[model samples]
Target: MKTNRSMIRTALAACGFGVVAMTGAHAADTISVVTFGGAYEAAAKKAWFEPFTAKTGDQFATESYDGGLAKLQAMEQAKNPTWDLIDLETNDAINACDEGLLEKFDKKTLGNTSDFLPGSISECAVAAMVWSTVYAYDTSKLKTAPTTIGDFFDLKKYPGKRGMRKSPKVAMEWALIADGVAPQDVYKTLATPAGVDRAFRKLDTIKPNIVWWEAGAQAPQLLADGAVVMTQAYNGRIDDAVHKDKKPFKVVWDAQVYDYEWWGVPAGAKHGDAARKFIVASTTPQAYADLSKYIAYAPPRKDAIPQIDKARLNDLPTAPANFKRPLQIDAAFWADNADAINKRFQNWLAQ
Candidate 1:
């Protein structure tokens, strides 16, 4: 049998099929991925990674992270990146690409650019889904439902502790919106010194009553435990709590800040080829549509919208009703201003 295999290899070599034969002889590669954990990770495993593994015979090693560029920068500085692909929020993705921490991706690899939502594809990343950061309250606790962004800050009327993420991004924007900044003027207003001061001042109103949460899972848990009457959270997390756990949470779409979650390849990935292939496979119109079955995040691809289950449409941030008065996150503004803004945010938190 050994002699027959050798003869077969030689014959294949002469016929120009040697590379194909040798490629088939190797075991599949394992792609290492890092993502924001909790329901998002579980949804990706079922909708993206698992199916990709089955199709390509490649395995995946997964890890979770809270969003930031610090870890990716550390890996690059050490000349050692263990992650093949990373799930990045828009601002982080922009920063990573600018710092050369992520591999440059060809937009052509994902097919027609027009099929996706505008600004979804970047030089180093491809958007996976559209998600929103919105405040949710327990329906059982609040008899009169809060209807506006201003209501989130009206503690006198809806007296209770508020749940907010520890970061400055969404919180700052929400502050301005609740202070009466129009949805389109959020970034413009935040760009000024007085605007920044105004936002922090509005935040001061609830500073003592704010329960800071750092993780996506914690937001829903905060509401469930009655630790907060209303909390700022990723829309999908609240959706999962409601549908999966039967929690009585109601998401307020007013002034909801929406952003894209992207798939980015680390600059020094060991399985770069496989990682790119997985991105292509996982972002197909059908694949994007299928993800909605697992989580409420809307697909970034315009074509995928039609494929989504009609029943799940209203739960997505892109739904017509929910999208009204929505504030699309200004990724470019955040990319340029994160460092300075974060410093101020940290100092304010300490005080």
Candidate 2:
């Protein structure tokens, strides 16, 4: 999707000093925005936060949190919510909306919902980026390169420690895909009891060789340090390591599961008006494009694509070459099944 540069300029111009327009007159001077820290935060500050601040004269108090409901729930229970905006994963946003912990959005305020990739905008959230969980190998270390998702599971052929997230989310999906389940059928197959068993059976084959990682940065570090030959990593992290750090890394995009991260207002936030303004400023085509320049995450809006530098296009998860065999994450499925599957995964991990 390509956005008209003129249209973007007009939209941002209209947003000038509109921080007081949300709930009117009671907006706070400072708003706290929560996000996962690192390159993502840095990009957001440059593209959205700083611009918004400069335009509105509103101060931002930034907070970092792993995407989870624990802190949100605690704030809600205490009836003392502090966070004005949240950067949430699709599943977390869905869950937060369901639990009445997030404020619903007005579609008109965020531009036309149709302009964004389908399934990216919700009643309570608007997409910030489309990112993927892909595996990468150190080219310097691997004698033979892995080309497919199945290759990630081939312990005998690769013959080295595999780096994987400690969580079961993407791991289980990759396992099913490696076991010959088509990307289209992955969720459907996992929905059945037999299929769940089949996925676990595949995962068991390389369990002993797995070196578990819990953070996004750890995956690239693991590869660089030779702690693991290949690791399930966020595509942006691997891209940065290769492009900026010049690490000898290669991403295997086949069968990658890509999904959206959203910007949403927490329910009962003190600075609701300012938060809403920030959301509008941040989701503009210009803002989204600016972010893509700083990080590898794909903007959710179709129009924002054209504004991105062409050289960086191949690194995006949404790039046509990488996206040809993509697996769009089914957040609804995970929201419904995560508890049960996570328990099962924990048990399997212990074994």
Q: Per-candidate TM vs. native?
A: 0.93, 0.90
Give a tens-digit lDDT track for model 2, residues 13-100: 5876243333233443688989876667777888788878766668788887657799999999999999999989888999999999
The model with the greatest TM-score is: 1
Model 1 clash tally? Answer: 0
**Which candidate wins on lDDT?**
1
The digit string of per-residue lDDT tens for model 1 on 300-320 reads: 888898898788999999999
Q: Against the true structure, candidate 2 has what lDDT?
A: 0.87
**Stretches of candidate 2 above 4 Å error?**
1-28
Mark the regions of model 1 whose C-alpha exceeds 4 Å error after superposition.
Answer: 1-25
